[model samples]
Target chain A: MPYPEELVSPMRAELTRLGVKELRTAAEVDGFANGQKGTALLVINSVCGCAAGGARPGVAMALEHGTKPDAVVTVFAGQDLDAVAKARALFAEYPPSSPSLALFKDGKVVHFVPRHQIEGRAPAMIANDLKAAFDKHCAKAS
Target chain B: MGTFHHDTHELHGITCVVETRGPRTWVGRVHEVGPAGVLLHDADVFDEVPGGPTKAEFLARTAAVGPWPRHKSVVVPAAEVTSVRRLGDLSA
Candidate 1:
């Protein structure tokens, strides 16, 4: 069963408010994953307690940095079933992990923060990790 | 301007084609091309024509044929991107 939409609505908006796009369908996930040109941040949003604690807040803080992903998007794991599945398929190369963060550049995997990384970490630490990747890969394209 | 640079920050909210190294070729309005990855809206993925055997000549062939879309608005990464090109202008 999926988490109630009412329960997750505010969580969804949390990321969207920071400009993260919510991918609500399988097609949406496929469209984003298939041929992306530059960097993208794909978050597998979940309803776990840790998600609220670390992933969500961490991502929001990470995006505040001067250098960040060109686009931010998310697919709720339990609620957006097909969308979440499709998103996972894109990560077929990597192990499946929800409440995860995958950053891509030019359609290739660059930085990944899996569930394990978030399960027992601080939002600030997570934010720092994402910021580090931004500094390295988000350089202006020549 | 002749000195125009495709600054990473400048790519926010515009449509373009992102050609990369692997099997994915993305097309959509660029949401952002930040240090981590590019975010896009109404994005679609076409097969990335590969190096020797499995590559499909997509844009070249598609341009000759007609406007066809493979996928739409989703998010991925940019670690393998090789090039970015302007396909059209975003509506103002």
Candidate 2:
């Protein structure tokens, strides 16, 4: 059954407030994933304990690093069904996982963080993992 | 496993979304679409989106979405999409 709007809205807001764009439909996912517009950070958000306790906070802190993606966007799994399906299309080679993080540059999957990585880890540790990806993929700001 | 690593440009050819059906059918959005494993965002509501049901009630009433395995991200085709919306800069 569809998740009520109430439970997912705050999670959406939390990501939105952090400047994370919400891809609510398939076209939007294509628009963001199709073109080579620098690096984009795609966060697969969830409502699990690990997400609240680790993933979300880790994402916020990781963005604080000097090197980062040009854009950061997100989608909720159970709620935005079509949108999530569309976004996953961009990762043609990889399998699907929730509460994951994928960094794309020039429209390619450069780095990925699977669910296992987020389940038990602390926010700080997650941030460190993301920061390391940023260092390797993100372009240095001039 | 080992620490995640790769070039950002390497993601160009992959799909960023995947469609999978199980006990509860729904789509997954790829937060980070890459070769390693895609990050999926499953939509849900809990005292947020207007007209949505309450969290407590939602949990009590609805079945969980899935039991997706670890270390895997699905690839969705672009043709299945219906629309796209930008949350920020509503004017955009």
Candidate 3:
């Protein structure tokens, strides 16, 4: 079952406000994965406290960096089962973990940062980590 | 994994097939792909022989850094990479 609509409302907004396209269904994830050209960032958005306090904010901060991903998208972990399943399917080489971050180039999971990396980190530190990952995997628009 | 096939570039969670100096192909997650070189994590070494069989042995390994834990990742130089691909996709 999905989380109550009112519950994750703010959680959804946290990323949407940053212009991160929410992949709310299987087809949406399929489309995003197939349609991507060059590099894309996938955040396994969650409703955990760490997510609210750090992950979302960190992603927002990372986007503010001069360099940005060609496309940024996310899937709600508990709310959108199909979407999350499909997203995680793409990242099959790694074990399942929530509130994870991944980078894909031409649709391949090039980089991954698991929950172990995010659990206790601050938003700014997460942002810094993402920015560094972005600097490596993501290309700044010309 | 037959019928579950996919080109690594089209699939997610892929390994690098970097070719540097000799004919060695490396497998690992890609860190960065830039003009200078590609950085890889959790890298492993392999050898591909033309018209011959392919063999992958743990001939090489590296410690991961930063957000990437050393146990599951490594840093690899992708400058001279001849090609990159995923071994295959997971279940549908």
For each candidate, the DockQ is: 0.01, 0.03, 0.02
* Candidate 2: true contacts recovered, fraction: 0.02
lDDT of candidate 3 over B21-86, digit per residue (tens)? 767656555556656665666555555667654543322222121122232554344556666553
Query: Candidate 3 on A1-142: residue-level lDDT in tens?
Result: 7668788878888888888999999999999988678889999988765577667888888899988788899998888999999998997767555677998888887777665456546889888888887788777767
Residue A116 Cα positional deviation in candidate 2, in Å, after optimal superposition: 0.8
- CA-lDDT, candidates in order: 0.70, 0.63, 0.67
For candidate 1, the per-residue lDDT at B90 reads 15
Candidate 2 — which residues are off by over 4 angstroms? B1-92
> What does candidate 1's lDDT look like per residue over A19-91, in tens digits?
8999999998888877798789899887765578888999989988888888889999888899988887876
Interface RMSD (one decimal) of model 3: 14.5
Which candidate would rank higher by lDDT, 1 or 3? Answer: 1
Which has the greatest lDDT? Answer: 1
Write candidate 1's Cα lDDT for B16-53 as tens digits: 67777777777665667766667766555676344543
Residue B60 in candidate 2, Cα distance off native in Å = 38
Candidate 1 regions off by >4 Å? A140-142, B1-92
